[model samples]
Target: MNSPHNPLDADTLRRLQEDVIDSYDEELELEVDDRILDGPAGLSDEARESRRVYFRELFRLQGELVKGGAIKRITQRLNPRVCRVAALPAPNDREKTQWYFQRFVSHLPAAGEIVLFDRSWYNRAGVERVMGFCSDEDLEEFFRSVPEFEKMLVRSGIRVIKYWFSISDEEQSARFLARINDPLKQWKLSPMDLESRRRWEDYTRAKEVMLERTHIPEAPWWVVQAVDKKRARLNCMHHLLAQFDYHEVEHQPVHLPPRERHEDYIRNPVPADMFVPDIY
Candidate 1:
């Protein structure tokens, strides 16, 4: 009997594992607990995120396993590039974004429209500069490159729409607490999260620069008050979907053979093991 409390019960999970185990045998064993979850938010001057390192590994693994679903966009202008998404990289002495730009440039005329879950194409004035990823030279370089990149993208007909979902330290703290308490969601923990909290003001200052430096008339950035998840999801989807003029691609009804043509299609064969039911 199925447990009402469990749709995909542990027994079912075990069985499903059995089916996939043959295919996954050795690689599954190699998959160790990276424990890369971002630690929950804590702001007491003395409070340290003990669980941070574990979460960083977890978040890294998550980056490996899932890439968010992309919605295709085609505008009057072609907006060849939709948006660039990426996790902030390990900052180098030379550049926080040098490697990022290199990778992004490599995808020039992207696979399709690029819709980033997190954007890397621009380091902006916010996070990178505030966090000291670059000296004044790097900031100058980013500003220097900004106009040309925009011009290139504009000339190419790639419409750019950037959405920054901002979360306050207090709000993030609540979310972190929820994650910490919930076993199922514990996987979302990460060390970067702690760093982000510790330097919230720095990130905010950086974001302000990001807004000023990067926000262009041709491709305006929309700031969503991401305090509410439902609102944020709805806002993003509504805004994104609005950009495309997707006339209903009418899918014609599936055709079926004429009644007479398919009359023999139901020829039933008795299975040798199909035991005839015993009469009551």
Candidate 2:
């Protein structure tokens, strides 16, 4: 499909869906909507409210996994053997992303290779540039800084693995529609989404330039067929783990234990005068 307006038939849809799903982070999806919601002007009133409801429900579940303390290793969040999920948001820009990631990264319970899902950091590819979200000079500065940054990361004795998940205009629209139509997935949509959707070709052009400029021998963007999402994720995971030359990572050493002890640990009652609690 030359343009985003072009619709894909059912067969095309399935193949494209698989491609989109392939690029999924297994743990983090990192889509346009997420980037928009996290940064930029933000979402609309109704859409924001809708997203609030979705994230509340979604985080409640993710939080359950966290508080249950059933999962100790960070990778377990993505391990298909443990939690089989597809297409999640990667908050590289968020303090929580940077902080939690630092913690999660420091301790790898299992041995595995480290492969980058997105070969080139997305900020340069299409996300920051074409959208006018990032200034031209800022974009140039980022490009100049990336090589040295990556050089250091590579010298750390960590293998630099990068994968560029590419989707056609047809494929992107299909997934966008899927997000729009599916309520469970509706939170995936954002106001900036339509704006980006309109510029599929322009984005593609930027992606090409991004690859040309940034693809270094040390860490280059690997353009993968994104017509199928599962294929992309599995391929990415396989490549990533392979980098580590890892032996079998022990399954959750911390088992998903049944709720053992329960107590009414609710705020303990204090003496009447000792503590004057808030009077609602």
Candidate 3:
């Protein structure tokens, strides 16, 4: 019988295997103790030597992972002022009365600013279409208007970059399962998210139609293979950075002035009741 999900590619399988191995290695590292190292109950000399080498390599690799924080520090140097807006909420009665594009206008970036819309006007093409939040006429209007809307933005000197994160059905299921099992992530699964999972094919079809209609020269859509989260983030960041010829700005050197101590200046003590317990 043919499987509903696509078969895992060799690359994906390798990644998964690596993830599993890492997880198991971490657990083993945590559980290691003096007894295990001492080769308890007459372990072979060769076996003991192999165990020592394995742990030595594992600890060395773990140290490298800790040092990987340097990559994050380097990326921080490229940080532009970013305004991240959460996904647009379901339209209220007032919003329904207004033109769909009107709400998005307020969230648009200023000349030198960058605004990231977690979910944008594409909701009309995806969720709104699949969930019947908008009528067929409304959806058609969005499809007709979006290309021109984007063209207008480009003409106004706003660089519009669009990304569609593509994940396989099987990978999505695994993610949903992980969220369900994880207490911290349970809040991410909304009723709409659950419903969308049920209508995956419908959403997929809507996405295809959206891409076909709205893909324009002014703002072409870039699809990111998102089944591997780390790779997806790195690829997305790399592609986004390549969009413009941005260079680091030269800044005047900053000098810190020494603090002046005034004879009359006195520090006040806080009341004991005002302090919170230092639980940590």
Candidate 4:
């Protein structure tokens, strides 16, 4: 295991390369290509020109999200349990018997913590509803109750901001195909995902219904145009940062305490066989 400060190893280098390739802005790529082909400028200059605006904006916006130096008691909760349940095994009989939102209630953020939900209870309105895992009555009930539930969350000082990432079918299909062809990403192409690809129209309809019914002033859904991954991430973060009125927090000067040392203290060495090979 390399230290965080160390340079990347072979596997890490390959992964980073792959990620860069995956997120390569095609629109930028075309512009750069056109400039290089038609103009007197070199590849580097054209490429730099294409990325300058976006990268500049992205970094500037990201700085805002990072620089809020505060310990303010704004509680936001992310339901990791819900995500685990979704990705892991099916809900057992007991879980099925419990009130649908009951499990989620415990995961709500306490005062001062921030809670975020990736899939959230809206799973009922999307995948579960589309896949026939949940009944029509359950679906209707979820739609009916979601607004009030969100309103209650707002009343309790939990700021709920929901975002739906939208991509065109052509972009989605291209992304799915990319995953299928890439051995490293193949695991992401599950049967459920493939099924969702087949039922694109169904998901769109479900999303429309969800937005219509659940669009409360307290917790309205924001749709992100996500065909471009880089733009989507930057745009979402920028939007989220804009939602808060933030000021830099004041802090007292820090003083490091002197380290205590004992002359008699000695560290022990491990056996040669105990050390793993430095393969990298």
- Local lDDT at 76 for model 3: 33
Give candidate 2 misplaced runs (Cα > 4 Å). 1-121, 249-280
State the lDDT of candidate 4 residue by residue for 48-144, as single tens digits: 5545655555546544644440001011112333212222235578989988877678777776445555447888899998999999999998988
Question: What ranges in model 1 sit over 4 Å off?
Answer: 1-100, 108-114, 252-280
Local accuracy of candidate 3 as per-residue lDDT tens digits, 1-280? 1134646556555444444443444455566532335334444677457556655544443333223201231133233454334457777889889988888888787776666667799999999899998899999999989999999999998889888989999877766655664465679899999998999999999999999998898899999898765455556655665676755565689999999999999999999999999999
lDDT of each: 0.53, 0.52, 0.69, 0.67
TM-score of structure candidate 3: 0.73
Q: Indicate which candidate wins on lDDT.
A: 3
Clashes of each: 21, 20, 0, 9
Model number with the top TM-score: 4
What is model 3's C-alpha RMSD?
10.1
Clashing pairs in 3: none
RMSD (Å) per prediction: 16.3, 13.9, 10.1, 10.6
Give per-residue CA lDDT, model 1, range 151-263, as digits (tens). Answer: 77767876667788777776676565555544655687877666777887878777887788778887778887777543454455556656656543444799997766665
Superposed on all Cα atoms, model 1 deviates from the true structure by an RMSD in Å of 16.3
For all predicted structures, in order, the TM-scores are 0.54, 0.51, 0.73, 0.75
Descending-TM-score candidate ranking: 4, 3, 1, 2
Q: List where candidate 3 sits over 4 angstroms from the true fold.
A: 1-83
